[model samples]
Target: MSTEERLIESARALLWERGYTGTSPKAIQQRAGAGQGSMYHHFSGKPDLALAAIRRTAEEMRAEAEEQFSAPGTAVDRIGAYLRRERDVLRGCPIGRLTQDPDVMADPVLRAPVDETLAWLRGRLAEVLEEGCERGELVGAPDPRAVAATIVATLQGGYVLARAADSVQPFEQAVAGLLDFLAARVPTDHE
Candidate 1:
């Protein structure tokens, strides 16, 4: 990879491990196997490099979500597919983890990608919920936005639970429980 590419990938890895507050330009430089001058040539500083890495992570996650959302099936099926998508349960949500880092949350420019990415995802899930209602698959007056928020929270919290327990079972159980509820609550017409 090019020096810039290497730097960004290294940033992603480091950010995932150490978060915004814990990572530094020098550390990133060392991890990338690039010199300080080279890193500076490509990025203004640590924050700038972090912005690129965060944006990349958001895009990657959004793409995966879209893949599941686009599949042929009811909203529940699509969402279930997404909930069950392969994940490193113990690693937690990369973007969500940033929210815990003071530095990341403090920087407006740095937080934009993370905020927008999550907002877009919640909106997309809400759209799916609305579609399900329209198709009569879900028979309830549920607020799509609220349901979407709950769904995302469940997944995000699932990761946290898994990481805390040092096991994937909690994550799997959380998703399974959420999916089961969503499936069981299938709206009935004229109820």
Candidate 2:
């Protein structure tokens, strides 16, 4: 990869593994096998490079979600697919992790992509739920927007629970509980 690409990728990985405060420009340079000159030449500074990395990670997250959202299935099925998709559960979410970093959250430029990505996920999920309700699949379902928010919360919370316990069971149980809640809302005739 080019020096620029390497730098961005290294930053992305470091930012996920360590928080913004913990990932220094020197560490990123070392990981990328690029020198100080290369890093500065390609980007203005750490924040600039971090913005690029965060944006790339956010974009990847959206694309992955879209894959499940657009799949041929009912809304619940699609959502379940997303929840159960293979992930580095122990490592936690790349974008979600950024939310915990004070440095990232404090910087509007660094935080914008994180905020936008989450908002987009919630909105997209709400759209799917609304579609299901309109189709008579999700009978008597709660408000789509609220439910979408709940789903996002549950998923993020699940990550926290799993990480705290150092086990994936909590995450699995959390997801299963959510799936059950959603399934209960489905019309009996459709089940």
Best by lDDT: 2
Q: State candidate 1's TM-score.
A: 0.95
Instruction: Give the alpha carbon lDDT tens digit for every residue of 38-70 in model 2.
Output: 999999999999999999999999999999999
List candidate 1 stretches off by more than 4 Å: 187-191
Superposing every Cα of model 1 onto the true structure, what RMSD results? 2.1
* Model 2 residue 85 lDDT score: 97
Q: What is candidate 1's CA lDDT for residue 122?
A: 95
Q: lDDT per prediction?
A: 0.89, 0.95
Where does candidate 2 stray beyond 4 Å?
none
The Cα error of candidate 2 at residue 169, in Å, is 0.8
Evaluate candidate 2 by giving its C-alpha RMSD to the native, one decimal: 0.7
Tell how far residue 106 is off in model 1, in angstroms: 0.7
Error of 1 at 52 (Å): 0.5
TM of each candidate vs. truth: 0.95, 0.98
